[model samples]
Target: MDTKDNHSLPSDDTTRLADTNSPTTANPAETTGSTTDPASTTSPTYTGITEEFNTEDIQVVQVGSVLKNRFVLEEMLGRGGMGVVYKAQDMRKVEAMDRDPYIAVKVLSKDFQANPDSFIALQRETKKAQQLAHPNIVTVYDFDRDGPNVFMTMELLQGEPLDHLIRRIRPSALPAQEALSIIEQMSRALAYAHSENIVHSDFKPGNVFLTSKNVVKVVDFGIARAAKDSDRVVEDATIFDPGSLGALTPTYASCEMLEYGTPDPRDDVYGLAVVAYELLAGSHPFSRKPATYARDLGMKAERPKEISKEVWQAISHGLEFERDKRTINATQFLQEMSGPRSGRDSRFPSWAYPVTAAAGLLMAVALVTLMFFGNGDGQPEIVLEETSSLAEEQRTRIEDLLEVAEVHGLVGRYIEPSGSSAYDAYQQVLALHENNKQAWEGLHSLGDQMVVAIQKLLDDGKQDQAEILIARGLEKLPQHEGLQALRESF
Candidate 1:
């Protein structure tokens, strides 16, 4: 759970879902007094939003409505989405006397409940999304229903959406370096999802959020997007499309998505590029036109003078009208832009360093030789310190750290709980002794455990979850044959 909570709460084992607000789930009462206007002047001017979802018969949910005696709908969070999002109060948490009982809930219309299978599909995707623990992705908690209304709950974030930011910064580009940072964060989130065979078919500025802390979080993972799984029969029964919920933003949607073609990572790559361009130029590449329309009209985006040739080329590649000619995925897009930065750097790998952190060059060189001195009961102990560089105190510290690492490994705390997991403990050892064979081997062993765990997901027919774990493992052990093999097998 790589969370930066709205109440300044710390991230825990499970990232609590929270956010300031997006235009669709727009206007948290704490921030503004304005009611939702889909035709709001600030929103992107895209016309492809046909009333395909037929929301005119939209069910009205009052602010004070209570559902199933569990959650109390308190405020209308926003109205620009396929459904209404609310800042709700959890009766269970309130009953428990919990300090933070408020949660963000997105309530789907009657169409969702019309076909129970669609609810099942949404639940399955929500489950897959909960495992996406990256800092830059929104954390979904669970999905449930209250009579005919279906809703999903997540952490309550207190910040502005990326679309708002882009609107606020219009007429001028975001500083080159600053835009790079935003692009990298977006890519990291997309890359993590792509690794799990998941594609955010609908990627747009509205879905991208920027917390008050200035951290980027891409929202709406699986709620109302086209499924890429060829075997899935979730959407076959309903002609009632999720796109009516505004899942697919035509301006940001790729040519393939607009044509109802096969889903691919390149679709997201194209969307990412559109958002990235907006960050740089503060405007849509094709003036808010859908990909197919823009391509047919022979419209080409003019590179902003502020961006460099290298960066513009990367952004342009993603804007290609054809999937084959477009950027392959977010990873390649990030690399093409300006390479990895800080926590998301691929060079450090998530196995040795935590995926949510950049624990780079922190390993100490541990050159250990254990021997028994005088009071020996047959247990090997560190007793020799050959030089000042290998001080007795340093040796003792290394031994203590190694012991801690070994203990964490045995209990299966490989790369969690942040700084205290086996990976972190082992990293601490290496920071003290870079040449420590025990620490390196320990990291590899942890990688092996990850492989075994992912295999279990695959065996259980949880391919999406398994792929996500494999991506995380490869980050730490890119060269680990087992992890690599799992990736190629996918």
Candidate 2:
């Protein structure tokens, strides 16, 4: 059977004396408190320095009461640019004909709320999004302002974001086959938006949400734009213009999309192509350095064959430098994607070699299921012999979990217990097979953990102790993700 809490806790040697009132979930919560309020009048920085733990810092805003009886804000789900996303109950028409009563409340930043210029951009885009209705799209229920606060109420989705999925299935580079599936849905989403004349300016993986059923939905229409000019923020010459929304993701933006001009719907296709290429290549097609820094650069798209030739044609077409030369739309690319020569073949020819190689890259993961618990070392209690059938079953289970971890890691949740455990499981496999790529990947997941741990220690006024423990861990594994990040700071 698969064990849930088989790993032991940290030894007493490493334990810090945590206070009873110390915050459990939100570490350094102050640092992330006012993510959008640009005005200096906002609350003090929750930098985890002076205030270790306080109830005021984490006050829950009453949704219905605060925003003029529109919706009652409950627990916070997550935070992002513009405002925080909260689980809210809609009291808009509760006394009328009966209806399901909850919705997502997206609160805008105070500074932006005060700025008529910025606030109007949010208002225009949300109004346009409210007009859209699709099963694959997150429905915008209504838009309203509460006194000085602005918020958009919409359907609350209950699954991980596509960004989450990408993190879970992080490939050093993705298989062309897998990459094709992601791009297909993304194309459909873009096509739907284009038909509605609403451009999803930010079309990165983070915008996609995935349900338990593998159903995908494109979300976050906060910065979406209309076919014509609703350039409210641009009038003020703001540092960022949400209404003149074009590609915000530099990693995936096309050359045309990046230049100074109004973006067309085709820009979305170009961005999608870049995403598809990254999924297969396990890296961005464009270099971070400016074109001037690298003299040999050209207008051609990076060859998919660099990762998988089978995907090269789709990549090349999607990333064509000239808008007219590029694939006309997502539908055209979808057709090409369905063909036999695409990355769908069971056995690829030499041209398909690279992506095929990625498929076989096993991340050996071992499940150490022992009979003891309460030990501080955190080592697996159970260690079956290498040849036993029970050991094989455990190994299989761990491998499956590792696959999920790989996907989740890429999506940005790799440091969670589930994510790190997958890495721990792979390390056990590495004990048996030294050069396993998956094992190394599991090791890579530790980067986030080490950083979090170090930050906590610093916040607790134990900088010297934090450095010492971090140094010891790094000396043992030089390439470990956690240590590499720390090294960069020094």
Candidate 3:
């Protein structure tokens, strides 16, 4: 079923799948018109669009309608060709029982429901998606049929689709850091799904949801194909299941998908690359036409000046037409973009260097002694060493703790003070060495930095942001004087 528009569908006896024959638009977000605004009288409209389903033929569920005596439909979030998505409250579960009492319901349209084959295909595909449980992927709770209506309950998210975000911030792409952050989360999600042998055939911006908390979630895995059954086809009478109707955005479809009607992990990698390219350059990699294996009919994407060389190279590699030549997988793409992690560098505070250096020197001396002064038994002559082995071990432990503490301090300084990096690191150091003044000082310093950040937020009249920062800081460092003072101020 073509549930392309992110909407809920109603039940009907028609055989046609929802939105399957709808005209494709240049903009992916245009597939589904802007969601209905409950507060506004005017409905959102899109240009160059033709919906296949006739609104007059289907019975639209009204607001406040209760489904299965459990989900109370509240507002229409979006509508796609195959379904309508609604923000509903789970009356059976209280807020205390369920952290999120609100849920998203994707109800199939009447036309889609009328086609038994399409309904079965959707059910089978959604069942497969249930196996994918990860922090970066939207959580699919349950799928059920209430009388004529078929719907799936998923985590209700407050965020804009990536396509909408791109459209809203066009001409200027997302900041480099923000784009990378989103990509990192997306890669992890794809990697996890790939590990489970699931390949998202339709990985595109429209399917990526970025939450208010800056978390990137990959949705619509319901149409994903299993890697082990690459050639498997769904024989739905109503739809041509070119690997689940090959329901993919043409702009992001990989060469394999276009050429052979098959997809693998590389297809997803290619899609992610296209997304990264668009985010960095504020345009598609191919300007004139969508990319195809048989022809390179468009201008090649030029590297954005704002993006770093390493990141651009990674993105370019991922955009390769040949599957074998593309970035091998999502994990590799992320590694290339993020670069390799090495030992702590100059960013580490000055005081941290002395402890690290001393620890290294001690280890070096110990190693040299072991090599040159081996006893007859082949073990190092501990008795002849300048310092006791126990002393050396203690120094090494202290060094390790200090290194961790330094890393935490740096993370807190640069990323976010509310993060447990500095606080947890300091606590570990104190546990090992109670007299470690640096750890204590670092903890207090982090608290002080957090207070400064909160104050700045308040000064800028971002009271909500400041309160969130203060709450996070206090949660981590309840005893910190600066955090305590900041809490009082709030």
Candidate 4:
């Protein structure tokens, strides 16, 4: 099986599953040859083009029919475990009235539709996905089942899959901070779903999307289950092998997910973090395969630190196979994300920090002079000194900037071919205080030479990517007069 095969679901004998193939432009005249024709000597009178953008030149393939009413299907956009996606259009609107360009339609296979369990999964996804309205999640507009056929309609996203992106960039080779930010955004989406009692059981790179606008959308909730629901057991659910269909990527799956067989918030954390580790360190934290593959490898694997000490620690606690050792929940995870790499300055006050610092100070004081006051006499003085460090003005500012830089750099790290003010600001901060421990750490955390590295990946084409990078820079360092001016120039 090609790892890149988007659709991995098994095909039953009764149902017809189309092999995902690129769209073939059979009827260019239908798409390009319109009623409005200019004085062109060309035989095929096409529409919507001068000499620059010609729809006739592009090949268009029909994938599936839409609404069974207006739209005719085009080429495949992607294929996954469940359905196949294709660029489609409303023939009524396009050929006749000449309206919107295209839309995406996801069609279920005959085999999948025949399985009652698949039908239930489809219904559950549609209901939950319909309720989710966010920029980071794929929008579900309308869903319909025409006889045995089931399909979903959505905005056409002209972009590359995140799976290819990771492979292209080789995320494991990226900087920790960059890797962490991608995970953070993904976490934010997962957190939202978890709040609604949703579990994206099939959370993976293929399910994540990046639009031209740098907008991230977590997609393919088709197979996702509600957190409280039990895994569906359909005797006929074996479009694939019965035992293997339930399996998720073991590299990312939590122990509890395998044992309890329930969807938990920690499951998402583990899976997403696995992606994070891969993006940051350029490899999976666990060298072992999912279930069956684990037997050959040792039960325990090398830690993230084996790649880099900074990442090892950043990902260490999160990668704990045991749920308890991991971040308690997304809320706590965000709370831990409070400082620089958090994309915020430490100057921002949180009750947790002051409280922890105070407690630490008090503990130090008590330990120093148990006898000085005999019974907590000099404790107050000692505690004051210990906690006072957090209160220092210079130290606080440095820490805060470090935090902001960290977070901004995290964002910047993923900005392909980056040369943004955010990237520059992060770089400047590091350069300004080379010896400053906080700055150095932040710089180390920033991770990835993406701005420069991505150039090599895309044949040195950085126009669109640079624009995004510039926008990202402006987002973090709005006060940067130069960046502010550049944003206006664009």
The most accurate candidate by lDDT is: 1
Candidate 4: residue 105 Cα off by (Å): 1.3
lDDT of all the models against the reference? 0.64, 0.49, 0.60, 0.48
Over the stretch 1-490, how does candidate 2's per-residue lDDT look in tens digits? 0111112211211111111222112100111111111111222221232233232344335433546655777656554434566666666556554486766776754435544555566677778787655545677777777665567777765656554444445556655444544565566566667777777765665567654434456776545342123342343322233311221444444455344346676667777776776677665556432212222366344564445454577667777666788777665665454434543553212222232221222211211111334134786554233322336554554454454344333322333332133344455566655545445545543444445556667779998967875785575446454455566675
Per-residue lDDT of model 4, residues 334-371, tens digit only: 44543333344653322223223433443344444432
Determine which window of 10 residues in candidate 2 has minimal summed lDDT. 26-35
TM-score against native, each model: 0.59, 0.51, 0.61, 0.55
Question: What C-alpha root-mean-square deviation, in Å, does candidate 2 show against the real structure?
Answer: 19.4
Per-candidate alpha-carbon RMSD to the true structure: 16.3, 19.4, 13.6, 17.8
Q: How high a TM-score does candidate 1 get?
A: 0.59
How many pairs collide in each candidate, listed in order? 32, 26, 19, 24
33 Cα displacement, candidate 4 (Å): 31
Off by over 4 Å in 2: 1-66, 92-100, 173-178, 222-236, 239-247, 287-296, 299-310, 339-490
Give the distance in Å from residue 36's predicted Cα in candidate 1 to where it truly belongs: 8.3
lDDT, residue 147, candidate 2 = 60
The 10 consecutive residues of candidate 3 with the worst lDDT sum are: 38-47
Off by over 4 Å in 3: 1-62, 94-100, 110-112, 224-238, 241-246, 341-490
